[model samples]
Target: MHESKLIIAGGSGFLGQVLARYFKTLGWEVIVFTRSPQANRVAREVQWHGETVSQWTRELEGATAIVNLCGRTVDCRYTTKNREEIMDSRMKPTRTLGEAIARCKNPPSVWLNASTATIYRHTHGPAWNESGEIGATPEAKDEFSVEVARAWEETFNTTATAHTRKVALRTAMVLGDGPNSVFPVLLRLARLGLGGRMGSGRQFVSWIHEADFCRAIEHVIARAEFSGPVNIAAPNPLTNAEMMHLFRGLVGMPFGLPASEWMLEVGAFFLRTETELIIKSRRVVPGRLLASGFQFQFERMPDALRELRMRMTGDVKCTLPLPAI
Candidate 1:
């Protein structure tokens, strides 16, 4: 029997590496398409400048699935140059992949493109499903992010790929133990007694555990009914204050120093990142996945945080080696 091949574009990042390691353990031949191919990387690496068709296009033929996680990290300050790169990075790769898949003799059955949960308007009232309202709110400071997401999905929706089913993964913040992931940073802050609520602390944080994230992707890939925009977040979205309280408890910290909106803005400027990332209320939920009978291993925030904490402290052993980011 021939082995199934999985291609991940921009697979050197935190989420990409997680997916690569998980799929590899499931007996899939994982190939990472990256601009910087390293010999010591976790999976096989293929080089491709994201916007153009190259020799890497051949790998798309006869592949089981192609996951496009290609996008500039939104962790930096949103300058004019950074804004342009951020928008271009997402749209160009999506457009290029569509072209490649269209030309392939045997294109992958499914294409999962990365999108963001920040596309939804800021709301503390109710959780947002796939069909939720999408727009920017001045309070969230997510205008640029919403613009980027809208253009990115628009490009993917307009692209014509006759044989492949496409799914836009409108993912929230993914919690993992990787250095590049948010988990370690938050954990470190908790340990330092700084894991307090930021701004008003009422902003809802939508998140998913790394394990469930991988499982959710696999679930979507196997189910043909899943198409268009799908929310990849846990069902129980908690407030920023609530999440930080959990973190403080997990770390055995009695007190945490809270940062006001102005303090957050000042800190963000020094950190070279935007405050919108932390302040936005992303109350996204996986409606299609749940409606289709997909069960999440780590559904709630407390369970997910405890599991990650245990793994970090060596209380629980991981089955697979950590993938290099």
Candidate 2:
């Protein structure tokens, strides 16, 4: 008898792809929901329109959990149009999935949704907990990091299911391989002698490894005790400069010139990306995940980057101190 599997919405994304594969390796079947046309893969495919729930609701039959990673990338610049798309993209699938779970004859016991860490204020030197001061829009910036982050969480929390355990993952940047990889891209730039800190290099970057990220999801799914907002990030936090140094070390390049806040703003304006992502400091901690007994395989940033580099390029390099947490 095979162990039952879980359902993953947006399972084709970078993070979702890693997670779907991870769960498969653990001998659990995976049902992926996406708006894209069917692509051949290891997991079962369920067609979704992103506007209304489909008959794919049957996929939840006898499933172990449902992890919803569906949301527009917050990395993009926030224009009025982008804002609508972001909100709708996030809320639509959320409402659809929640409604589907609510209507399922046998819904998965766990429902984990994607959220953001920018939801917390990042006023350098200040620390935020699950209870500490949540973010208010910083007066200096026009970007809607706090607003979008708040609305994203609000949409998830209000849309509920009485039968299913809903877990919202207030996650930070998830670094890994293939597309959306922060390593090879940054390392490639580093190898090209372009690697350096963005903006002031003082902003805090909270992250989770690809391997451990999968485990954390599984931990939440199987634990049966964890619910509500959980911060999925590394215990060992680092600054933008620290991250740049690690990357430069990995790719054998001296850390190059740092991009000032103004430069990032100008560049992001052209690229339609958000500068607050790299400009505003976010010293976020994983207070809930740690206390919940979720052990991370690579809690430290340097180690995680090294392992990821090894996996991608098959190159062995200098070692890093593993995080005890």
Local distance difference test scores for all models? 0.91, 0.77
Candidate 1 stretches greater than 4 Å from native: 316-325
Worst 10 residues of 1 by lDDT: 316-325
Off by more than 4 A, model 2:
139-143, 319-325
lDDT string, candidate 2, 1-325, tens digits? 8587888888877888888888888888888988774768758788787678778888876778888888777668677888888788888888888888888888888888888777777756655656646766463263476776677778788876888888878787788886875666777767877678887777777777878788888888878778888888788768778888888878777557778778877888897887766666666778887887778888788778888888877888666543322
Deviation (Å) of 158 in candidate 2: 1.7
The residue pairs that clash in candidate 1, if any, are none
Q: List model 1 lDDT by residue over 73-143, tens digit each.
A: 99999999999999999999999999999999999999999998999999987788999999999989999
Q: Indicate the residue-level lDDT of 272 in model 2.
A: 81
RMSD of 1: 4.5
lDDT of 2: 0.77
Residue 307 C-alpha lDDT in model 2: 85
